[model samples]
Target: MDTEDTTGDLITRTGFHFHIRHAEPEDEAIVADFFKHVTPEDVRFRFLSGMKSVSHERLVEMTSSSDARRVNFLAFSPNETLLAAAMLAVGKDPQRGEVALTIRDDYKHQGISWEMLAHICRYAERHNFKSIESIESRENHAAIELERDMAFRAYTDKDDPTIVVLRRDFRP
Candidate 1:
């Protein structure tokens, strides 16, 4: 599949292939629908809140934003089913960006998270970010381990004892 289109890019993993692309404002409906399949626990993990449902306003902001420093990526299965979503928010500090990743409820353990995080790392690097960080709840062992495996160092958040900051400083 061609990787040059604005619609999406087809990426092949070890045993499967999927399409990933930047989200557009028109994707608000689908992006909102994508949240329906995300587990409640994951929703909390993703938003760091007890949100049972993603608000329409939040979805709108995510899809409608034209900010150059903020990007949201969506991953879809070969059959065009949305599988995962990721966000990279670059703050004033050009040296770092904060990232978040979420997968559909039934798609866990499929390596999508790893691919998404790796892709985000490369994306951050290309944009001149020297590091990327993810704030994770301490209870989220799987995500913490995944980040550690990717060479991200875990530091106790200076302000939050209930969470840790996983940061990966890219090599210059």
Candidate 2:
């Protein structure tokens, strides 16, 4: 059962199914295309920026895997349509990692975000990160509630009043 959960790239939960894989540089084009389908508001919420569109530089950064401490995962529907993308990046503090995820607006509320986030949390745990955190825009109620439902505690970011840090700490 454990192996089944860890090894398979396919996930089916709550009557929804999607394939997930570690991202690669070659995926830039598809990711860019996927973002084009995402709503501007969703993009702002995901990136915490007001950019009307995702830039080529940002796409390249998201698709690249040169950083050993970071891993980005991409999700696709059974028919090969991109559904979502998630990132887990561990910084100098090895015990803590930051997570960011976004789902195509059309796919929102179908449990894709929840499933993708849960998977990223599991990855962080396995990697020995004592805690996982995400910085979310204060206006992003949907994401804040989702993270809270997953046992993440939300707190205002000290340096930025416009954002909140949602954190889930692992038990030693």
Q: Which candidate is the best by TM-score?
A: 2
Provide the lDDT at 36 for model 2.
Answer: 88
- Per-residue lDDT tens digits for candidate 2, residues 41-158, read 8899889888988899988888877767777788999898989988888788878988999888888778888888888788777767799999999998999999999999998888
Task: Please give the RMSD of candidate 1 to the true structure.
Answer: 3.3
Query: Global lDDT for candidate 1?
Result: 0.82
> What are the lDDT figures for the candidates, one per model?
0.82, 0.83
Highest lDDT model number:
2
- Model 1: clashing residue pairs? none
lDDT of 1 by residue, 18-118 (tens): 77887878998888999999989899999999988999888876675476677888898988788888888878886788999889988888778887788
Question: In model 1, how large is the Cα lDDT of residue 171?
Answer: 70
TM-scores for the candidates: 0.91, 0.92
